[model samples]
Target: MKRSTCDICHFSIKTCVCSYVVSPKLNNKTRIIVLQHPSEVSVTKNTVRLLTLQLTSVEVYVGEKPSDFTVAQQIAKTHHCGLLYPDQNAIAVESMVSNSQTIDTLFVLDGTWKKANKIAMLNPWLNHLKKITFSALPENKYAIRKAEQSYSLSTLEACAYFLECYEKLSAEPLHHLLTGMIHEQTKFMPEDVKKRYFHEDD
Candidate 1:
């Protein structure tokens, strides 16, 4: 397999995007943690890791075993933990807080529906987390994943949207830019799936 370089920064994975991607400016002391599936680490097109790129407070960790919980556990020590999952019966993301207090540990699982389910199930600690169900009014603008709507967003997209929604700010442009990155990655997909993913709702 060949590697793709960032057109703007010209950085490769081991040295470039991973080392110097800029993070998003944040307020109110919110922290984001992306528990990426180990399989996603090598996919040059995966956008999940980009959360840490735009958000200085965000961290990314990948693995199969929950025993690799040191980093997450450390963060959970100080911040109340909330897992981002879509289940209508689940509590709203906003309700995770009380009395104007901000949550410190927010776990956003990044993967396909099947992979995410396996990861969540494999990690018992994740299941114990306070689940957050997001019902955002905004539609998902991520062109890469090409879902029916914004109702279901990728990991990075969800993080960006959550920040925008809770902070009352516009993150749409940034989300579109992330979609551009996805466009670069399309070459790696099978031709038919690539066409389907890109032209789904058009």
Candidate 2:
């Protein structure tokens, strides 16, 4: 598959989309490394790639565990390294704070449930890392895809919501830019898929 920084929504290079690119400057001490499923990288509407484009601190490792301990070691250097997932057994992101004033790292797995699980399990080193769960207020408004009703969320959705809860961050302008992009991409979805996912039942 061909790779272009181009977004399906704006048909513009990823960095050019200022709205999607301008993530709130994370705490300098906090590094976010995203382990994305290779397949997710190719999907036109996926948001992990967008986040990758926007943040310089974020490291995107394309495939399975690296041959050496380099990547895990780098992430471990941070004061904290927590996995981003909603598993009940996982500790809440908020609860992980030993000191709210200090910066820490958050490692997020970006893919479908099964895909994320495989990524986590395949790298045993990652299993020992701290885990951080989150609580969100249900801002599932993006038009590009449907959210799993009970707890599942798209990578973008999870990141945006996490930022909101922890940073008390709100970026209406950025959200507008992202939603507009989503609308642009989903505009061409087949009628059947649109009908199936366009509207969530009340």
RMSD of each: 4.7, 4.3
lDDT of 1 at 122: 83
Best by lDDT: 1
Off by over 4 Å in 1: 1-28, 94-99, 146-151, 186-195, 200-202
Residue-wise lDDT of candidate 1 within 1-202, one digit each (tens)?
7676655444354334432343444442467788888887776556765554555577787875777667786676667777888665667665444335545567887777777787788887776676777755455556665453336676776777666655554555456556556655564679888776666555
Q: Could you tell me which residue pairs clash in candidate 2?
A: none
Model 1 Cα shift for residue 87 (angstroms) = 3.7
Tell me which residue pairs clash in candidate 1: 22-53, 23-54, 23-55, 24-54, 24-55, 140-150
How big is the positional error of residue 75 in model 2, measured in Å on the Cα after superposition? 1.9
lDDT for model 1, on a 0 to 1 scale?
0.64
Lowest-sum lDDT 10-residue window in model 1: 14-23
The per-residue C-alpha lDDT of model 2 at residue 68 equals 35
